[model samples]
Target chain A: MDKKLEVRDGSVVLKVNPEFYPLDIIYSAAYVFLDKAYVLLDGDLKKEILVKLQPKQKQDLEKLGGEFLNELINYADYKHRAAQTKTIREYLLQRALFTNDPSIIPDDDEEVDYNEILNELEEDDEELDDPEGIAVPWEEKYGQKDEKKD
Target chain B: MKKKIKLVLNKNFYDKKAISQAIKDFEHIAKITILDDEFGIELLQKEPLEEPLKEEFSNYVLGLMKNENII
Candidate 1:
């Protein structure tokens, strides 16, 4: 098999095809390695991208190259799956928000007054029947007990 | 002794604004001159640093690009 990565001068170089890995995906992968290595990108964006990774500490260049390649695949798959589920994700979000609060959805036919709704809620709270005085606080119904001697 | 390093950043890969910001941030440490696609950096201090200046500068530019959402 032909070698895809080049190791020289304590650095690993990868010639990434732009078609297989988009520029954004490459950027995302490169960002993840910023702290671990010195990442330098140079090449034709339309054709091939040359990614150079110089590890901060002593390590195998081949392994570093392999990790970078894996990151590229990881970002590519994430982007692909994100694009595929975008519509569904948006739909689910809409459903969740609407279910949680139907008042958030705008209604063209009816004008809503927030203050009026709040007033109605207050009135409803006042109208609530508490035959057993269950709504009363314990402190309000009973006097505070005297502290026991230590 | 003053040291100088030349870095040629391709227009297709690098964002001009990010490079400008990186240069501005590192101006205290080095005198950076921009000529089209190339950046000429002249070190002001003579002391040996922990990391290579050229690599650090390039990494700074890359960081700026990512932080500014240019890449």
Candidate 2:
């Protein structure tokens, strides 16, 4: 399979090939680290904000074992996109810490807050304006309809 | 932090005398609750508190069980 995406920096990178493994596998690994590897993370980066998997987090992948990594993606397929994303975020974030990649790893005493207020606003507007486009129902405004309705 | 999620395997992963050599293997990283009467071995792991991660791990274990035809 060809390189599907590359999360790169000066020293390290994760070159993903979608053909070899599904997207969920990549995502689940990331999610695992974000939740379990907090102690391995820089203290400054730990507080004040949620940490996301950096682009270059391939180094720590070995420790999780080949079976675990394989299981991650396989599980992602069994689960759903949201779950896979969290797992991928964890796996990637943990790898970033283990590898000591300065570019991706936040510095000590750094304060970062990830807020998507604009995204939320845009989403809200989209939901209001394009009723059919959104997946979730707007129960308050539009009465719930049976999903199997003809 | 991960919690021990129990999974029972249809066959035990051990032999009586040889198994005694390893102490840590018996101790589950997650949690192995064995149902002696049932035909399976239990595998466990700590689950992350994060909802999505928890669900993924849950599915991962469930997938393993399903894939292996354990349950």
- Tell me how far the alpha carbon of residue B44 in candidate 1 is from the true structure, in angstroms, after superposition: 5.8
The digit string of per-residue lDDT tens for model 1 on A1-150 reads 556799999999999999999999988998899888998888888888999999999999999999999999999999999999996686556556766887775665432543345457579889999998799877665645423322
TM-score, chain B, each candidate? 0.79, 0.29
DockQ, cand. 2: 0.03
Interface RMSD, all models, one decimal each? 1.1, 14.7
How well is each residue in B1-71 modelled by candidate 2, as lDDT tens digits? 54444433222212222222221343433454444643233444554333332233333442333334443
True contacts kept of each: 0.68, 0.00
lDDT of 1 by residue, B2-57 (tens): 77677777667777788788878887777776765444444443455688777787
State each model's C-alpha RMSD to the native.
Answer: 8.3, 21.7
Candidate-wise lDDT, in order? 0.80, 0.38
Query: Would you give me the overall lDDT of model 2?
Result: 0.38
Best by lDDT: 1
The residue ranges of model 2 lying beyond 4 angstroms of the native Cα positions read A1-14, A37-61, A65-68, A76-150, B1-71
Can you tell me the CAPRI class of model 1?
medium
How much does candidate 1 score in TM-score? 0.73
How closely does chain A match the true chain A in each prediction, as TM-score? 0.67, 0.23
